[model samples]
Target: MNALMLLVQKLSCDVEEHVFSEVSLAIEKPESYFEKFKERLDERGIDSPIDQLAWISLVDALLDHDLAFELDWKESGLYICDVVDELLDRKKMAYISWGDFEDEEFDELPTSQCLNEISGKLKEVGISLAYLDIDSDSYVLITVPSSDIDDIKKMAQEAGYSIQDSF
Candidate 1:
């Protein structure tokens, strides 16, 4: 199994939210969607960092699920509201996981225990573990406050986990 890590800032919008808001718009206007969306988000008082890969993954996932409205970008905009409503109804956050470990290696990976430990440690510092993506290879993608990133890294390191700066 391949062990990889990514240091990502948690966005205010989850997968569903991002898909409805940004992805939908981007699909309709592929040329300058991000710039426009960023401007809109700024106006709305949201300052979360946007990850292009995450958005691409969301679009792909939507397409794979046959949730994409239509091939014509112009008509695609019509489904934005519907897609947002449907995804909101599902109430699921989007996350990606990696790793292909054997049953025996499951316990050796960063299991719930390790995550709970990290969560507790972070909580003490006033940082909540909002979301997590972990795989059998001990690769972890954690979402926490950007301000607490360094602290979280230190704690993870002290707990015997190596932090990779990127994927």
Candidate 2:
């Protein structure tokens, strides 16, 4: 499904007006590949969504005590993992009317929707959340460049993903 792509519009300096940038994330693993990854979370006793495994992967990738400090969310009174939990809950409540979603809190969203919400929140710091498939085993995080390119690049590089200005 073309569900992994997000279209972003930009006012180009050279263009007549606007141009479209495709936010095509790269997740370089098969379904079975995640089982090993899930073990890491399981060892830590963290339960996350299955349908949106990509979302869980993002949470694992970005979860850090220093994240709130680096992102200036420390004073926002929540840890990165805490924000992630709240986001999952918000999605659950938002889709509580749907029988399928209501049946399971963690599985309340499609991957695209979850990624979109995370992207929106990241945008607050001039970063966009996405996956970049760097190898055959797992997904690596990436960002869409904005006014905060330097910080974004550092984060992506620290996460060990190649930086791309556009998809």
Local distance difference test scores for all models: 0.36, 0.36
**Top lDDT hit:** 1
lDDT of 2 at 23: 16
lDDT of 1 by residue, 1-167 (tens): 10111211122223445445454454456545646555544643435444442344333334434333122222222132233234333434232221222234433433334344434444454444422222223222333444655654554355334333232
The residue ranges of model 2 lying beyond 4 angstroms of the native Cα positions read 1-107, 135-137, 142-145, 148-167
Error of 2 at 31 (Å): 30
Would you list the clashing residue pairs of candidate 1?
none
List, residue by residue over 4-93, the lDDT tens digit for candidate 2.
211111111222121211111214452443555657557545454344444344334333211111122111212222443343343231
Clash totals for all candidate models:
0, 0
Off by over 4 Å in 1: 1-22, 26-110, 132-140, 146-167
Q: Mark the 10 consecutive residues where model 2 has the least summed lDDT.
A: 16-25
